[model samples]
Target: MANIPVIAIVDDDEAVRTSLASLVRSIGYEASTYESGIDFLNRQSEDPSCMIVDVQMPVMTGDELQARLVEAGRRFPIIFMTAFPTDAVRQRVLAAGAHCCLSKPTGGDEIIRCLEEAMAGHAAQ
Candidate 1:
């Protein structure tokens, strides 16, 4: 909620998570990486921030995680990413109130933009 936004990045791919964390940190935000959605849920940090999750994780998919978050009454904005992007998947994530559903090759600028948008929505509340 301050100047340095905290972003939770959940993905099964170690390389993807590492790269994302590095990129996110380079942009001056705090990034926490989790190997799986269940891992993140276990930590349960009450940090008010946004999330970047992979759609094809091993245990729980990004969409499934979003549903669980909703069931638990958690409203942090999410940006779902997938290598195999599809209209149906995008629509599903969007309908779950995600800020965006982006392809895996999304750049830092796009991620930053989504983060800013998500922060703005939180600010409004």
Candidate 2:
């Protein structure tokens, strides 16, 4: 995690991206928003402390993004969020070494909790 603790929120939905960014900022962390996985992959210059990425997106999914990061040797604690969550999805992401998996319509506190857990080197359930 970065000393300043930036939390990157990546999702295809404009509303979701905005809301999570705002909520994360309110809690005293630098929040960056991206509308897609490719956007974050191409645009992010500085590494964030944690990532809140949507599971389902147009071009690339959160799991795929994680895989890319791993291959590139850039590891950030990742929290995967999904509107349509399933046990298989959850298990797969966890197996792939994601920090946490969250359901959409999630509250700010839950996100904070996940972030906290991740930063502490613990995978949140």
Candidate 3:
């Protein structure tokens, strides 16, 4: 059987993590949740097909995680979500190669679209 793609979700908010995980699973991808970027870095055993991350996480923000991954030569596609979306932050992450930065309470359809784009881009690379 082909390996099912895994989606990693990193958020400080437990409720957000739970909901995203359920959504990912409902869409037929495996979901793994991490409370913070540090938790994800410490526990991740394999590269996820894509990452859905929160920008304002306490221990390590989503942008920081992306930097670390880049510094380590990891190329996982990342999608960032934040309650306080800013032009500066969005531009920064996009410049740093993040797939996209989204606002919190984003619709499931938008997330699914971004995931599809990210996965397609990753596969092409």
Best by TM-score: 3
What tens digits encode model 3's per-residue C-alpha lDDT throughout 1-125? 24899999999999999999999999999999999989999999689999999999776889999999999999989999999999999999999999999998899999999999999999998
Q: Across residues 32-63, which tens digit of lDDT does each residue of candidate 2 receive? A: 88988889989996778789999999889888
Global lDDT scores for all candidate models: 0.89, 0.87, 0.94
For each candidate in turn, the TM-score is 0.93, 0.90, 0.97
Better of 1 and 2 by lDDT: 1
Considering every candidate listed, which one attains the maximal lDDT? 3
Clash pairs (backbone) in predicted model 1: none
Worst 10 residues of 2 by lDDT: 116-125
Model 1, 1-112: lDDT tens digits are: 4667788999999999999999888978899989998999999657548899999978689899999999999988898999999999999999989988889798889988
What's model 3's TM-score? 0.97
